[model samples]
Target: MTTRARPAIAAMAYHQGAFVPFAEAGLPLTTQALQYGTGVFEGIRAHTCADGGKLVLFRVRDHYERFLRSCRLLRIETGHTVDELVEITCELLRRNGTTADTYLRPLGYKLALLPGTRPGVGLSGVSDALSITGFPMGAYTPPGGIRCTVSSWVRPRSAAIPIHAKVTGGYVNNALAADEARAAGYDDAILLDDRGRVCEASTANVFAARSGRLLTPPATADLLPGITRDTVLALAADLGIETAEHELDVSDLRCADEVFLTGTGIGITPVNEVSGHPIGAGEPGPIARSLAHHYARTIRGGGDVRHHHWLTSVRIDQG
Candidate 1:
Protein backbone atom coordinates (compact mmCIF):
# COMPACT_ATOMS: atom_id res chain seq x y z
CA MET A 1 0.00 0.00 0.00
CA THR A 2 1.39 3.40 -1.02
CA THR A 3 1.14 6.12 1.61
CA ARG A 4 0.90 9.86 1.10
CA ALA A 5 4.31 11.59 1.23
CA ARG A 6 4.87 14.30 3.82
CA PRO A 7 6.92 17.47 3.20
CA ALA A 8 9.46 19.03 5.55
CA ILE A 9 8.42 22.61 6.15
CA ALA A 10 10.93 25.37 6.62
CA ALA A 11 11.61 26.88 10.06
CA MET A 12 10.16 30.27 9.18
CA ALA A 13 6.69 31.32 8.07
CA TYR A 14 4.99 34.56 7.10
CA HIS A 15 2.17 35.08 9.57
CA GLN A 16 -0.25 37.91 10.25
CA GLY A 17 1.68 40.42 8.09
CA ALA A 18 5.05 39.51 9.55
CA PHE A 19 7.69 36.83 9.05
CA VAL A 20 8.13 34.76 12.19
CA PRO A 21 9.40 31.44 13.43
CA PHE A 22 6.95 28.70 12.49
CA ALA A 23 6.58 27.83 16.15
CA GLU A 24 5.55 31.38 16.91
CA ALA A 25 2.78 31.45 14.33
CA GLY A 26 -0.40 30.53 16.11
CA LEU A 27 -4.07 31.50 16.35
CA PRO A 28 -6.14 31.91 19.48
CA LEU A 29 -8.47 29.09 20.52
CA THR A 30 -11.51 31.23 19.80
CA THR A 31 -10.39 32.46 16.41
CA GLN A 32 -13.40 32.49 14.10
CA ALA A 33 -11.67 30.83 11.17
CA LEU A 34 -10.36 28.11 13.43
CA GLN A 35 -13.77 27.59 14.95
CA TYR A 36 -15.91 28.03 11.84
CA GLY A 37 -13.59 27.05 8.98
CA THR A 38 -14.04 30.46 7.41
CA GLY A 39 -10.72 30.54 5.59
CA VAL A 40 -9.35 30.36 2.00
CA PHE A 41 -6.04 29.08 0.71
CA GLU A 42 -4.04 28.38 -2.47
CA GLY A 43 -1.49 25.66 -3.23
CA ILE A 44 1.49 26.94 -5.21
CA ARG A 45 4.70 25.19 -6.24
CA ALA A 46 8.19 26.49 -6.95
CA HIS A 47 10.59 24.31 -8.92
CA THR A 48 14.38 24.33 -8.80
CA CYS A 49 16.00 24.02 -12.25
CA ALA A 50 19.13 21.89 -12.54
CA ASP A 51 20.72 24.02 -15.25
CA GLY A 52 21.34 27.24 -13.25
CA GLY A 53 20.05 26.43 -9.76
CA LYS A 54 17.17 28.85 -10.27
CA LEU A 55 13.91 28.47 -8.34
CA VAL A 56 10.90 29.49 -10.42
CA LEU A 57 7.39 30.07 -9.07
CA PHE A 58 4.77 28.61 -11.37
CA ARG A 59 1.70 30.76 -12.11
CA VAL A 60 2.13 32.71 -8.88
CA ARG A 61 0.10 35.73 -9.95
CA ASP A 62 -2.70 33.54 -11.17
CA HIS A 63 -2.72 31.68 -7.87
CA TYR A 64 -3.00 34.89 -5.89
CA GLU A 65 -5.75 36.18 -8.15
CA ARG A 66 -7.75 33.09 -7.31
CA PHE A 67 -6.67 33.38 -3.70
CA LEU A 68 -8.10 36.89 -3.44
CA ARG A 69 -11.30 35.75 -5.08
CA SER A 70 -11.67 32.96 -2.58
CA CYS A 71 -10.98 35.43 0.20
CA ARG A 72 -13.75 37.64 -1.10
CA LEU A 73 -16.20 34.75 -0.93
CA LEU A 74 -15.54 34.48 2.82
CA ARG A 75 -15.19 38.22 3.38
CA ILE A 76 -11.57 37.72 4.39
CA GLU A 77 -9.48 40.63 3.32
CA THR A 78 -5.86 39.82 2.52
CA GLY A 79 -4.94 43.50 2.02
CA HIS A 80 -2.37 42.53 -0.59
CA THR A 81 -2.52 42.99 -4.35
CA VAL A 82 -1.55 40.19 -6.70
CA ASP A 83 1.83 41.81 -7.39
CA GLU A 84 2.36 42.32 -3.65
CA LEU A 85 1.50 38.71 -2.87
CA VAL A 86 3.91 37.50 -5.52
CA GLU A 87 6.64 39.72 -4.13
CA ILE A 88 5.97 38.44 -0.59
CA THR A 89 6.24 34.86 -1.82
CA CYS A 90 9.55 35.57 -3.53
CA GLU A 91 10.88 37.31 -0.46
CA LEU A 92 9.73 34.47 1.79
CA LEU A 93 11.51 31.94 -0.44
CA ARG A 94 14.71 33.97 -0.21
CA ARG A 95 14.44 34.14 3.59
CA ASN A 96 13.80 30.43 3.96
CA GLY A 97 16.86 29.72 1.80
CA THR A 98 15.36 26.50 0.45
CA THR A 99 16.93 25.38 -2.83
CA ALA A 100 14.57 22.57 -3.72
CA ASP A 101 11.10 22.01 -5.07
CA THR A 102 8.87 23.86 -2.58
CA TYR A 103 5.15 24.02 -1.95
CA LEU A 104 3.52 27.25 -0.75
CA ARG A 105 0.25 27.68 1.07
CA PRO A 106 -1.22 31.19 1.34
CA LEU A 107 -4.14 31.36 3.73
CA GLY A 108 -6.59 34.21 4.20
CA TYR A 109 -9.09 33.78 6.96
CA LYS A 110 -11.48 35.37 9.45
CA LEU A 111 -9.94 36.07 12.81
CA ALA A 112 -11.68 37.34 16.00
CA LEU A 113 -15.11 38.91 16.01
CA LEU A 114 -15.47 42.67 16.37
CA PRO A 115 -15.96 44.14 19.85
CA GLY A 116 -19.59 45.26 19.40
CA THR A 117 -20.61 42.48 16.99
CA ARG A 118 -22.13 39.20 18.14
CA PRO A 119 -21.35 36.15 16.02
CA GLY A 120 -23.25 32.92 16.08
CA VAL A 121 -22.52 31.84 12.47
CA GLY A 122 -21.72 34.69 10.16
CA LEU A 123 -19.19 36.23 7.72
CA SER A 124 -19.46 39.86 8.76
CA GLY A 125 -17.80 41.76 11.62
CA VAL A 126 -14.81 39.45 11.87
CA SER A 127 -11.14 40.40 11.77
CA ASP A 128 -9.10 38.97 8.88
CA ALA A 129 -5.59 37.55 8.79
CA LEU A 130 -3.17 36.20 6.20
CA SER A 131 -0.37 33.69 6.48
CA ILE A 132 1.98 32.11 3.93
CA THR A 133 3.93 28.96 4.62
CA GLY A 134 6.34 26.88 2.58
CA PHE A 135 7.19 23.19 2.48
CA PRO A 136 9.98 21.33 0.73
CA MET A 137 8.13 18.84 -1.42
CA GLY A 138 8.40 17.09 -4.76
CA ALA A 139 6.30 14.76 -6.91
CA TYR A 140 4.93 11.99 -4.71
CA THR A 141 2.31 10.10 -6.76
CA PRO A 142 3.35 6.88 -8.49
CA PRO A 143 4.36 7.54 -12.07
CA GLY A 144 3.37 4.02 -13.06
CA GLY A 145 -0.28 4.80 -12.14
CA ILE A 146 -2.64 4.51 -9.20
CA ARG A 147 -5.93 2.81 -8.37
CA CYS A 148 -9.03 4.87 -7.55
CA THR A 149 -12.62 4.31 -6.48
CA VAL A 150 -15.84 6.11 -7.28
CA SER A 151 -16.64 7.79 -3.97
CA SER A 152 -20.08 7.43 -2.40
CA TRP A 153 -20.04 11.05 -1.22
CA VAL A 154 -21.53 13.24 -3.91
CA ARG A 155 -20.05 16.70 -4.48
CA PRO A 156 -22.06 19.53 -2.96
CA ARG A 157 -23.75 21.78 -5.50
CA SER A 158 -22.48 25.32 -6.10
CA ALA A 159 -25.77 26.61 -4.83
CA ALA A 160 -24.92 25.25 -1.40
CA ILE A 161 -21.22 26.15 -1.53
CA PRO A 162 -19.03 27.87 -4.09
CA ILE A 163 -17.13 24.97 -5.62
CA HIS A 164 -14.96 27.21 -7.78
CA ALA A 165 -13.08 28.75 -4.83
CA LYS A 166 -10.72 26.96 -2.44
CA VAL A 167 -12.69 27.84 0.64
CA THR A 168 -11.46 26.07 3.77
CA GLY A 169 -14.85 24.93 5.01
CA GLY A 170 -15.83 23.55 1.62
CA TYR A 171 -13.03 20.94 1.73
CA VAL A 172 -14.83 18.75 4.28
CA ASN A 173 -16.67 17.18 1.38
CA ASN A 174 -13.37 16.38 -0.35
CA ALA A 175 -11.86 15.06 2.87
CA LEU A 176 -14.75 12.69 3.43
CA ALA A 177 -14.56 11.40 -0.13
CA ALA A 178 -10.79 10.92 0.05
CA ASP A 179 -10.91 9.16 3.40
CA GLU A 180 -13.55 6.81 2.09
CA ALA A 181 -11.37 5.90 -0.90
CA ARG A 182 -8.17 5.46 1.09
CA ALA A 183 -9.90 3.32 3.66
CA ALA A 184 -11.20 1.12 0.86
CA GLY A 185 -7.58 0.48 -0.29
CA TYR A 186 -7.64 2.99 -3.14
CA ASP A 187 -5.11 5.75 -3.72
CA ASP A 188 -7.70 8.52 -4.23
CA ALA A 189 -11.37 9.26 -4.73
CA ILE A 190 -13.24 10.36 -7.85
CA LEU A 191 -16.41 12.12 -6.78
CA LEU A 192 -19.58 12.50 -8.82
CA ASP A 193 -22.04 15.36 -8.78
CA ASP A 194 -25.57 15.11 -7.34
CA ARG A 195 -26.70 14.31 -10.87
CA GLY A 196 -24.14 11.45 -11.11
CA ARG A 197 -21.79 13.34 -13.45
CA VAL A 198 -18.09 12.87 -12.70
CA CYS A 199 -17.06 15.95 -10.69
CA GLU A 200 -13.36 15.48 -9.98
CA ALA A 201 -10.83 13.70 -7.84
CA SER A 202 -10.38 14.56 -4.17
CA THR A 203 -7.81 17.29 -4.77
CA ALA A 204 -7.19 17.35 -8.50
CA ASN A 205 -8.98 17.73 -11.79
CA VAL A 206 -9.88 14.69 -13.90
CA PHE A 207 -8.77 14.07 -17.48
CA ALA A 208 -9.38 11.08 -19.64
CA ALA A 209 -7.71 10.34 -22.97
CA ARG A 210 -10.00 8.81 -25.55
CA SER A 211 -9.59 8.53 -29.28
CA GLY A 212 -6.33 10.52 -29.03
CA ARG A 213 -8.24 13.45 -27.50
CA LEU A 214 -8.46 14.66 -23.93
CA LEU A 215 -11.86 14.91 -22.22
CA THR A 216 -12.53 16.56 -18.86
CA PRO A 217 -15.55 17.72 -16.92
CA PRO A 218 -16.59 21.28 -17.56
CA ALA A 219 -16.23 24.07 -14.96
CA THR A 220 -19.95 23.68 -14.29
CA ALA A 221 -19.49 20.22 -12.82
CA ASP A 222 -19.10 21.45 -9.20
CA LEU A 223 -15.31 21.11 -9.27
CA LEU A 224 -12.42 23.36 -8.52
CA PRO A 225 -11.04 24.44 -11.91
CA GLY A 226 -7.36 24.03 -11.14
CA ILE A 227 -4.56 26.13 -12.60
CA THR A 228 -2.71 22.96 -13.55
CA ARG A 229 -5.85 21.81 -15.37
CA ASP A 230 -5.86 25.00 -17.46
CA THR A 231 -2.15 24.58 -18.16
CA VAL A 232 -2.73 21.06 -19.48
CA LEU A 233 -5.38 22.30 -21.90
CA ALA A 234 -3.01 24.91 -23.31
CA LEU A 235 -0.15 22.44 -23.52
CA ALA A 236 -2.39 19.94 -25.27
CA ALA A 237 -3.36 22.56 -27.83
CA ASP A 238 0.34 23.28 -28.35
CA LEU A 239 0.98 19.60 -28.98
CA GLY A 240 -1.94 19.46 -31.45
CA ILE A 241 -3.89 17.10 -29.19
CA GLU A 242 -7.63 17.70 -29.21
CA THR A 243 -9.36 18.62 -25.95
CA ALA A 244 -12.96 18.91 -24.76
CA GLU A 245 -14.78 19.96 -21.59
CA HIS A 246 -17.97 18.00 -20.95
CA GLU A 247 -19.69 15.78 -18.42
CA LEU A 248 -18.36 12.33 -17.55
CA ASP A 249 -19.73 9.52 -15.45
CA VAL A 250 -18.41 6.29 -13.96
CA SER A 251 -18.89 4.44 -17.22
CA ASP A 252 -16.85 7.04 -19.09
CA LEU A 253 -13.91 6.52 -16.73
CA ARG A 254 -14.09 2.78 -17.16
CA CYS A 255 -14.29 3.05 -20.96
CA ALA A 256 -11.58 5.66 -21.53
CA ASP A 257 -8.33 4.57 -23.08
CA GLU A 258 -6.43 6.43 -20.34
CA VAL A 259 -7.32 8.32 -17.16
CA PHE A 260 -5.20 10.87 -15.29
CA LEU A 261 -5.30 13.74 -12.81
CA THR A 262 -3.70 17.21 -12.88
CA GLY A 263 -3.03 19.65 -10.04
CA THR A 264 -0.19 21.46 -8.25
CA GLY A 265 0.21 18.52 -5.89
CA ILE A 266 -0.29 15.59 -8.26
CA GLY A 267 0.89 17.16 -11.50
CA ILE A 268 -0.07 14.64 -14.21
CA THR A 269 -0.82 11.24 -12.64
CA PRO A 270 -2.30 8.34 -14.54
CA VAL A 271 -5.20 6.33 -13.12
CA ASN A 272 -4.98 2.63 -13.85
CA GLU A 273 -8.19 1.29 -12.32
CA VAL A 274 -11.52 2.63 -11.14
CA SER A 275 -13.51 0.67 -8.57
CA GLY A 276 -11.68 -2.61 -9.42
CA HIS A 277 -12.20 -2.12 -13.16
CA PRO A 278 -9.07 -1.62 -15.25
CA ILE A 279 -8.69 1.53 -17.29
CA GLY A 280 -7.65 0.76 -20.84
CA ALA A 281 -4.77 -1.76 -20.61
CA GLY A 282 -4.40 -0.95 -16.91
CA GLU A 283 -1.17 0.96 -17.45
CA PRO A 284 0.01 4.50 -17.97
CA GLY A 285 -0.67 5.45 -21.59
CA PRO A 286 1.49 7.37 -24.08
CA ILE A 287 -0.45 10.65 -24.17
CA ALA A 288 -0.28 10.97 -20.39
CA ARG A 289 3.45 10.27 -20.44
CA SER A 290 4.01 12.88 -23.12
CA LEU A 291 2.06 15.57 -21.27
CA ALA A 292 3.74 14.73 -17.97
CA HIS A 293 7.17 15.08 -19.55
CA HIS A 294 6.19 18.35 -21.16
CA TYR A 295 4.71 19.62 -17.87
CA ALA A 296 7.87 18.73 -15.95
CA ARG A 297 10.05 20.63 -18.37
CA THR A 298 7.69 23.55 -18.55
CA ILE A 299 7.66 24.00 -14.75
CA ARG A 300 11.42 23.52 -14.40
CA GLY A 301 12.16 26.41 -16.80
CA GLY A 302 12.62 24.39 -19.97
CA GLY A 303 10.29 23.69 -22.90
CA ASP A 304 9.00 26.28 -25.40
CA VAL A 305 9.98 29.92 -24.96
CA ARG A 306 6.40 31.11 -25.11
CA HIS A 307 5.52 29.16 -21.97
CA HIS A 308 8.35 30.80 -20.01
CA HIS A 309 6.08 33.69 -19.15
CA TRP A 310 4.25 31.44 -16.74
CA LEU A 311 7.33 31.20 -14.49
CA THR A 312 8.55 33.90 -12.08
CA SER A 313 12.28 33.32 -11.60
CA VAL A 314 14.07 33.58 -8.22
CA ARG A 315 17.83 33.25 -8.03
CA ILE A 316 19.29 31.33 -5.08
CA ASP A 317 22.82 32.16 -3.96
CA GLN A 318 25.14 29.71 -2.19
CA GLY A 319 26.20 30.86 1.28
Candidate 2:
Protein backbone atom coordinates (compact mmCIF):
# COMPACT_ATOMS: atom_id res chain seq x y z
CA MET A 1 0.00 0.00 0.00
CA THR A 2 1.21 3.48 -0.90
CA THR A 3 0.95 6.39 1.50
CA ARG A 4 0.14 9.96 0.53
CA ALA A 5 2.39 12.88 1.57
CA ARG A 6 1.05 15.35 4.08
CA PRO A 7 0.54 18.92 2.99
CA ALA A 8 3.10 21.43 4.20
CA ILE A 9 2.17 23.76 7.06
CA ALA A 10 1.10 27.13 5.68
CA ALA A 11 3.35 30.03 6.65
CA MET A 12 1.57 31.99 9.34
CA ALA A 13 2.12 35.13 11.43
CA TYR A 14 0.59 36.98 14.38
CA HIS A 15 0.09 40.64 13.60
CA GLN A 16 -1.75 43.33 15.54
CA GLY A 17 -4.35 41.05 17.18
CA ALA A 18 -4.80 38.00 14.92
CA PHE A 19 -3.10 35.35 12.82
CA VAL A 20 -2.70 35.99 9.09
CA PRO A 21 -1.10 34.27 6.14
CA PHE A 22 2.53 35.34 5.90
CA ALA A 23 2.17 36.61 2.37
CA GLU A 24 -0.97 38.55 3.27
CA ALA A 25 0.55 40.45 6.19
CA GLY A 26 0.79 44.16 5.54
CA LEU A 27 1.06 47.57 7.11
CA PRO A 28 0.58 51.14 5.87
CA LEU A 29 3.53 52.50 3.87
CA THR A 30 3.38 55.62 6.02
CA THR A 31 3.76 53.82 9.35
CA GLN A 32 6.13 55.68 11.65
CA ALA A 33 7.93 52.42 12.32
CA LEU A 34 8.49 51.96 8.61
CA GLN A 35 9.26 55.55 7.66
CA TYR A 36 11.51 56.42 10.58
CA GLY A 37 12.62 53.06 11.90
CA THR A 38 10.80 53.68 15.20
CA GLY A 39 10.69 50.06 16.35
CA VAL A 40 12.37 47.58 18.72
CA PHE A 41 12.71 43.84 18.10
CA GLU A 42 14.25 40.62 19.40
CA GLY A 43 15.60 37.46 17.74
CA ILE A 44 14.84 34.25 19.64
CA ARG A 45 15.62 30.63 18.81
CA ALA A 46 13.66 27.41 19.29
CA HIS A 47 15.10 23.92 19.21
CA THR A 48 13.47 20.51 18.82
CA CYS A 49 13.47 18.68 22.12
CA ALA A 50 15.33 15.38 22.33
CA ASP A 51 12.72 13.46 24.33
CA GLY A 52 9.54 14.52 22.53
CA GLY A 53 8.19 15.96 19.31
CA LYS A 54 8.09 19.42 20.83
CA LEU A 55 9.82 22.76 20.23
CA VAL A 56 11.52 24.47 23.16
CA LEU A 57 11.89 28.22 23.05
CA PHE A 58 15.12 29.39 24.68
CA ARG A 59 14.82 32.05 27.39
CA VAL A 60 11.40 33.28 26.31
CA ARG A 61 10.81 35.26 29.48
CA ASP A 62 14.19 36.95 29.29
CA HIS A 63 13.62 37.94 25.68
CA TYR A 64 10.20 39.35 26.48
CA GLU A 65 11.59 41.28 29.45
CA ARG A 66 14.23 42.80 27.19
CA PHE A 67 11.57 43.50 24.56
CA LEU A 68 9.46 45.37 27.09
CA ARG A 69 12.50 47.37 28.15
CA SER A 70 13.05 48.33 24.52
CA CYS A 71 9.42 49.36 24.21
CA ARG A 72 9.69 51.50 27.31
CA LEU A 73 12.77 53.16 25.87
CA LEU A 74 11.01 53.84 22.57
CA ARG A 75 7.70 54.81 24.20
CA ILE A 76 5.88 52.08 22.23
CA GLU A 77 3.07 50.93 24.49
CA THR A 78 2.74 47.26 23.48
CA GLY A 79 0.19 46.87 26.37
CA HIS A 80 0.70 43.10 26.43
CA THR A 81 2.24 41.43 29.44
CA VAL A 82 5.19 39.05 29.09
CA ASP A 83 2.96 36.04 29.71
CA GLU A 84 0.49 37.17 27.04
CA LEU A 85 3.24 37.65 24.46
CA VAL A 86 4.70 34.25 25.24
CA GLU A 87 1.29 32.65 24.71
CA ILE A 88 0.92 34.45 21.38
CA THR A 89 4.36 33.28 20.24
CA CYS A 90 3.69 29.69 21.26
CA GLU A 91 0.38 29.71 19.35
CA LEU A 92 2.10 31.14 16.27
CA LEU A 93 4.71 28.37 16.33
CA ARG A 94 2.01 25.73 16.81
CA ARG A 95 0.21 27.03 13.75
CA ASN A 96 3.40 26.95 11.72
CA GLY A 97 4.18 23.39 12.92
CA THR A 98 7.86 24.14 12.92
CA THR A 99 10.06 21.15 13.86
CA ALA A 100 13.54 22.27 13.03
CA ASP A 101 15.75 24.98 14.49
CA THR A 102 13.71 28.14 14.06
CA TYR A 103 14.06 31.87 14.57
CA LEU A 104 11.28 33.93 16.12
CA ARG A 105 11.13 37.71 15.77
CA PRO A 106 8.90 39.83 17.98
CA LEU A 107 8.64 43.52 17.17
CA GLY A 108 7.11 46.42 19.07
CA TYR A 109 6.73 49.53 16.99
CA LYS A 110 5.11 52.95 16.63
CA LEU A 111 2.13 52.38 14.33
CA ALA A 112 1.17 55.92 13.44
CA LEU A 113 0.52 56.81 9.79
CA LEU A 114 2.58 59.94 9.78
CA PRO A 115 4.33 60.22 6.42
CA GLY A 116 7.21 62.53 7.24
CA THR A 117 7.44 62.64 10.99
CA ARG A 118 10.94 62.22 12.29
CA PRO A 119 11.66 59.91 15.17
CA GLY A 120 11.31 61.63 18.59
CA VAL A 121 9.84 64.74 17.02
CA GLY A 122 6.17 63.83 16.63
CA LEU A 123 3.26 64.92 18.81
CA SER A 124 1.59 62.59 21.35
CA GLY A 125 -1.12 61.15 19.09
CA VAL A 126 0.61 58.08 17.68
CA SER A 127 -0.27 54.42 18.30
CA ASP A 128 1.84 51.38 19.10
CA ALA A 129 1.72 47.84 17.67
CA LEU A 130 3.30 44.42 18.07
CA SER A 131 3.86 41.42 15.78
CA ILE A 132 5.45 37.98 16.04
CA THR A 133 6.77 35.87 13.19
CA GLY A 134 8.73 32.61 12.98
CA PHE A 135 10.56 30.65 10.31
CA PRO A 136 13.19 27.93 9.90
CA MET A 137 16.74 29.17 10.38
CA GLY A 138 20.20 27.65 10.39
CA ALA A 139 23.74 28.57 11.41
CA TYR A 140 24.27 32.27 10.82
CA THR A 141 28.05 31.91 10.74
CA PRO A 142 30.10 29.69 8.49
CA PRO A 143 31.35 26.37 9.78
CA GLY A 144 34.87 26.10 11.33
CA GLY A 145 35.49 29.80 12.06
CA ILE A 146 35.12 33.30 10.56
CA ARG A 147 37.58 36.07 9.69
CA CYS A 148 36.96 39.59 10.96
CA THR A 149 38.31 43.10 10.56
CA VAL A 150 38.02 46.27 12.60
CA SER A 151 35.66 48.51 10.70
CA SER A 152 36.33 52.21 10.16
CA TRP A 153 32.86 53.04 11.50
CA VAL A 154 32.35 53.65 15.22
CA ARG A 155 29.40 52.55 17.32
CA PRO A 156 26.90 55.22 18.35
CA ARG A 157 27.39 56.77 21.74
CA SER A 158 24.91 55.80 24.48
CA ALA A 159 24.10 59.47 24.99
CA ALA A 160 23.18 59.90 21.33
CA ILE A 161 20.94 56.83 21.41
CA PRO A 162 20.11 54.16 23.97
CA ILE A 163 22.65 51.70 22.54
CA HIS A 164 21.42 48.92 24.79
CA ALA A 165 17.94 49.04 23.24
CA LYS A 166 17.46 47.04 20.04
CA VAL A 167 15.98 49.93 18.12
CA THR A 168 15.55 49.44 14.37
CA GLY A 169 17.06 52.81 13.53
CA GLY A 170 20.29 52.00 15.39
CA TYR A 171 21.05 49.06 13.11
CA VAL A 172 21.88 51.36 10.23
CA ASN A 173 25.17 51.95 12.02
CA ASN A 174 25.69 48.18 12.17
CA ALA A 175 24.84 47.84 8.49
CA LEU A 176 27.44 50.38 7.48
CA ALA A 177 30.17 48.55 9.43
CA ALA A 178 29.13 45.11 8.15
CA ASP A 179 29.05 46.35 4.59
CA GLU A 180 32.48 47.83 4.97
CA ALA A 181 33.83 44.59 6.40
CA ARG A 182 32.38 42.50 3.57
CA ALA A 183 33.64 44.90 0.94
CA ALA A 184 37.11 44.69 2.47
CA GLY A 185 37.05 40.85 2.14
CA TYR A 186 36.22 39.94 5.73
CA ASP A 187 33.40 37.72 6.97
CA ASP A 188 32.44 40.14 9.80
CA ALA A 189 33.30 43.43 11.43
CA ILE A 190 34.28 44.52 14.93
CA LEU A 191 33.11 48.01 15.92
CA LEU A 192 34.74 50.37 18.39
CA ASP A 193 33.20 53.08 20.50
CA ASP A 194 33.93 56.82 20.18
CA ARG A 195 36.92 56.51 22.52
CA GLY A 196 38.53 53.75 20.36
CA ARG A 197 37.73 51.06 22.92
CA VAL A 198 36.32 47.75 21.69
CA CYS A 199 32.49 47.72 21.63
CA GLU A 200 31.22 44.60 19.89
CA ALA A 201 30.86 42.84 16.59
CA SER A 202 28.52 44.10 13.90
CA THR A 203 25.51 42.22 15.29
CA ALA A 204 26.76 40.23 18.27
CA ASN A 205 28.62 40.72 21.52
CA VAL A 206 32.34 39.91 21.57
CA PHE A 207 34.26 37.70 23.98
CA ALA A 208 37.97 36.99 24.20
CA ALA A 209 39.75 34.33 26.18
CA ARG A 210 43.31 34.39 27.53
CA SER A 211 44.98 31.89 29.85
CA GLY A 212 41.55 30.19 30.32
CA ARG A 213 39.52 33.13 31.69
CA LEU A 214 36.77 34.79 29.57
CA LEU A 215 36.62 38.55 28.99
CA THR A 216 33.93 40.70 27.42
CA PRO A 217 33.23 44.40 27.09
CA PRO A 218 31.46 46.08 29.97
CA ALA A 219 27.82 47.23 29.77
CA THR A 220 29.09 50.78 29.33
CA ALA A 221 30.69 49.92 25.99
CA ASP A 222 27.64 51.07 23.96
CA LEU A 223 26.56 47.65 22.63
CA LEU A 224 23.48 45.50 23.01
CA PRO A 225 23.39 43.55 26.30
CA GLY A 226 22.73 40.30 24.44
CA ILE A 227 20.70 37.53 26.08
CA THR A 228 23.03 34.94 24.60
CA ARG A 229 25.95 36.78 26.15
CA ASP A 230 24.33 36.40 29.54
CA THR A 231 23.69 32.71 28.86
CA VAL A 232 27.34 32.16 28.04
CA LEU A 233 28.44 33.83 31.25
CA ALA A 234 26.11 31.59 33.26
CA LEU A 235 27.30 28.47 31.47
CA ALA A 236 30.90 29.44 31.98
CA ALA A 237 30.41 29.84 35.71
CA ASP A 238 28.76 26.44 35.87
CA LEU A 239 31.77 24.94 34.08
CA GLY A 240 34.15 26.48 36.69
CA ILE A 241 35.45 29.10 34.29
CA GLU A 242 36.23 32.64 35.40
CA THR A 243 34.75 35.68 33.58
CA ALA A 244 35.42 39.41 33.62
CA GLU A 245 33.50 42.40 32.23
CA HIS A 246 35.65 45.44 31.49
CA GLU A 247 36.80 47.80 28.79
CA LEU A 248 38.63 46.06 25.93
CA ASP A 249 41.04 47.49 23.41
CA VAL A 250 41.56 46.39 19.82
CA SER A 251 45.10 45.44 20.71
CA ASP A 252 43.66 43.13 23.35
CA LEU A 253 41.87 41.11 20.65
CA ARG A 254 44.95 41.12 18.48
CA CYS A 255 46.91 39.59 21.33
CA ALA A 256 44.20 37.37 22.81
CA ASP A 257 44.53 33.61 23.03
CA GLU A 258 41.02 33.16 21.52
CA VAL A 259 37.95 35.13 20.44
CA PHE A 260 34.30 34.44 19.71
CA LEU A 261 31.02 36.25 18.98
CA THR A 262 27.76 35.55 20.80
CA GLY A 263 24.15 36.49 20.06
CA THR A 264 20.67 34.98 19.56
CA GLY A 265 21.35 34.43 15.85
CA ILE A 266 25.03 33.44 15.84
CA GLY A 267 25.18 31.54 19.13
CA ILE A 268 28.88 31.13 19.99
CA THR A 269 31.00 31.45 16.86
CA PRO A 270 34.79 31.38 16.99
CA VAL A 271 37.01 33.92 15.35
CA ASN A 272 40.07 32.39 13.68
CA GLU A 273 41.64 35.62 12.60
CA VAL A 274 41.15 39.30 13.41
CA SER A 275 42.55 42.08 11.17
CA GLY A 276 44.98 39.63 9.49
CA HIS A 277 46.38 38.19 12.76
CA PRO A 278 45.70 34.53 13.57
CA ILE A 279 44.08 33.76 16.93
CA GLY A 280 45.33 30.88 19.15
CA ALA A 281 46.38 28.16 16.69
CA GLY A 282 44.14 29.85 14.07
CA GLU A 283 41.07 27.71 14.86
CA PRO A 284 38.09 27.39 17.22
CA GLY A 285 39.64 27.35 20.67
CA PRO A 286 39.08 24.74 23.38
CA ILE A 287 37.20 27.05 25.77
CA ALA A 288 34.85 28.18 22.99
CA ARG A 289 34.18 24.60 21.92
CA SER A 290 33.33 23.63 25.51
CA LEU A 291 30.92 26.52 26.00
CA ALA A 292 29.32 25.99 22.59
CA HIS A 293 28.76 22.31 23.34
CA HIS A 294 27.19 23.13 26.71
CA TYR A 295 25.07 25.85 25.15
CA ALA A 296 23.83 23.49 22.44
CA ARG A 297 22.91 20.83 24.95
CA THR A 298 21.12 23.28 27.22
CA ILE A 299 19.12 24.79 24.39
CA ARG A 300 18.11 21.35 23.03
CA GLY A 301 16.93 20.14 26.47
CA GLY A 302 19.54 17.43 26.62
CA GLY A 303 19.77 16.33 30.27
CA ASP A 304 20.73 19.73 31.61
CA VAL A 305 18.45 20.04 34.61
CA ARG A 306 20.01 23.33 35.67
CA HIS A 307 18.84 25.01 32.46
CA HIS A 308 15.42 23.37 32.25
CA HIS A 309 13.90 26.66 33.32
CA TRP A 310 15.30 28.30 30.20
CA LEU A 311 13.12 26.28 27.84
CA THR A 312 9.43 26.97 27.17
CA SER A 313 7.95 23.92 25.46
CA VAL A 314 5.37 24.43 22.72
CA ARG A 315 3.34 21.29 22.28
CA ILE A 316 -0.30 21.23 21.21
CA ASP A 317 -0.90 18.45 23.75
CA GLN A 318 0.27 20.69 26.56
CA GLY A 319 -2.38 23.27 25.69
- The best candidate by lDDT is 1
Candidate 2 error regions (>4 Å): 1-10, 113-120, 316-319
Looking at candidate 2, what is the lDDT of residue 160? 92
lDDT (C-alpha, whole model) for all candidates: 0.92, 0.87
- For residues 176-286, could you state the per-residue lDDT of candidate 1 as single tens digits? 999999999999999998889999999999999899989999987799999999999999999999999988989999999999999999999999999999999999999
Tens-place lDDT digits, model 2, residues 1-319:
1122343333998889899998887898867788888899999888888776899999999999999999988888887999999999999888887677788999988887445554564524578888888878767676588999998999989999789999999999999998888888888899998889999999999999999989999976799979999999999999999999978898999888999999998899999999999998999999999999999888889846988999999884434
lDDT of 2: 0.87
Per-candidate TM equals 0.98, 0.93
Q: Give lDDT: candidate 1, residue 98.
A: 74
Model 1 misplaced stretches (Cα beyond 4 Å): none
TM-score of 1: 0.98
